[model samples]
Target: MTIRTTHVGSLPRTQDVVDFIFARERGEAYDPDAFDAAMTGATAETVRRQVEAGIDIVSDGETSKISYATYVKDRYTGFAGDSPRNSPADLKMFPSFLERLKNDGGTPTYARPMCVGEVRSKGQGELEKDIANLKAGMEAQGVERGFMNAASPGVISLFLQNDFYPNREAYLAALADAMRDEYRTIVAAGLELQLDCPDLALSRHMLFTDLSDEEFVKVAGMHIEALNHALEGIDPARVRVHICWGNYEGPHVCDIDMDKVFSTLMGAHCRYVLFETSNPRHAHEWTVFRDRKAEIPDDKVLVPGVVDTTTNFVEHPELVAERIARFAGIVGAERVVAGSDCGFGTFAGFGAVDPEIAYAKLGALAEGARIASGRV
Candidate 1:
């Protein structure tokens, strides 16, 4: 198998595309045909840029969706836009969590309904639409290797406040079963599928903040079980799973130790594990893998983030190369791929780094990978 370097999640969005989509959605005067043309053009450009920069695997830039998690509310049944609210205080990344608490008895207010839906099985029509778009984009760009990100069943349950489900277990299981169809569809399309699962760790801090550490682990274990259930029968080689603390700039106090989650994460039937390791907050922790490298089975690949996503400073190519070399040293170079800490654009309305700078960072990442590979 060819080992390559890439990003864990999103790239920055073009300003014109972002403004155009929001304005049209909000009923401002914007032409639909023009919007489509611009979006397609921008997406193609983004992919071409990444490829030119030397990324082995490419993505559609996720420009079509606002936030990775909330975007699904519209397509899945049982969700309606709720009030816009601040992220939870216990969530660990949002600095305004406490300030939002000062009002309404310390509960963060939401503008949307906090995802009031239950996921249902994906129909063939929806699957075809998603795959066709991806395939069309890939064909247009002449790129053969690409992956599409989908929300894991656990993440869906956590983000979408499913008040309708009798209990959390049932809600999560339903989501897992519902999303299985989507998973199968991606596999059937003969393209790589990436399960975007930041909630794996973020949930412990945000949703279960009141629970004891032990209690949080139990609940998190259940979420992992549900995720595994959803991944059933999918070819491990074709799938990759990504996990991270919430992708924002803040104190990551709730960051769960990778050791605690490693066993459960490795249980998922994915060949590649895309994880955060380059951010200043977590860079030192890469040593944890050095100690635990033996536990990683031979069948799996590790894509550690070599580029920090929260900052604008382009990582020095030598530094990026060094990070990649470190991981390759621990887990043979053939089994290591370089990646970014997290998505550049986790949410639609919020971005900590400039878009142009984000692209430059990715370019640096690809260059760094080349340097590392040459050294190996």
Candidate 2:
């Protein structure tokens, strides 16, 4: 098959779903049954839109999630409602931006869930609902393959501060143990499982700015171990891993180079690696694959973001095709898949790109893949 087109999970939610989420976040009483119905409808609609845009592998738009990583708090036990608030070092460096966010009421103020007790999966029912919703959407659309995004143990640690654990290591181990059940369920449902693991690369600037390269790599290695452990008994072929240097537009000079951790990424047991490559910050880094193709396993596929998610600009189809062709030249067409740099709506109510433009970009991505396929 030629290079296929997909995107990082998450698409903009309709106004109704957004309101329901905000109501819950504000501690206002809301109807659980109503929320579930709304979520199911939204998931189905999102999937239909993805197929309409010609995406090969679609997701439920993570419509049921508040945020990609922190949504785990609701599905698992041991997390307290009162999560600590912290800012990325990059954001902290520019306090004016924070002030602007506050002024615009865009500075999300949800409590960060803390590890207040030992972690355990609430039940399979929570994830099963998602699986069922996604399956229903795929059935409705008559699509073949789809994926679901789950927060990695490491990303959970990065987003939700650990207060109860004796140390970070202890906290991460508990998270991995608890999240394994969810990981297994998705794959068992005959869907690809995409583990969102920004902690490996994004946390260096966002949360671990205080650590040195050696110390950060040590921590990152542990993070990968926890993910691998959760992925045990699951075929690597059925799983794909995504890494990014945080999804926001910021001065990413502090971000760690992919070279520093490429080996660690290649070490993941998963057979596919999806990463940010279209944005200006990491665009040039795609050459790393050409320079160091030896680091990538032959069995794995490389899904590079040829469409930028941070900006509103709808990349020209030719530009998108050009980007895909670059990677195809390096990794071979069969081993390449076109994707977005990061999620368009990384958070429920926090999308920077316009919803209409997001779909337009996806159209461009599909067109680009078609153009690249011809060339390859």
Top candidate by lDDT: 2
Which residue pairs collide, candidate 2? Answer: 83-112
TM-score of 2: 0.97
**Candidate 2 regions with alpha-carbon error over 4 angstroms:** none
By summed lDDT, the worst window of 10 consecutive residues in model 1 runs over 104-113
- Give the Cα error of residue 262 in candidate 1, in Å: 1.7
Candidate maximizing TM-score = 2
Would you give me the overall lDDT of model 1? 0.75
Per-residue lDDT of model 2, residues 94-191, tens digit only: 88986786787655555577778888888988678888999999999999999999999999998888888899888888888898889889998999
Measured with C-alpha atoms, the lDDT of residue 126 in candidate 1 is 39
Runs off by more than 4 Å, candidate 1: 1-3, 23-35, 81-118, 121-130
Candidate 1, residues 121-214: lDDT per residue as tens digits? 4365634654666677778878888887788877776677666778889888888887788778878888888998876787777676788767
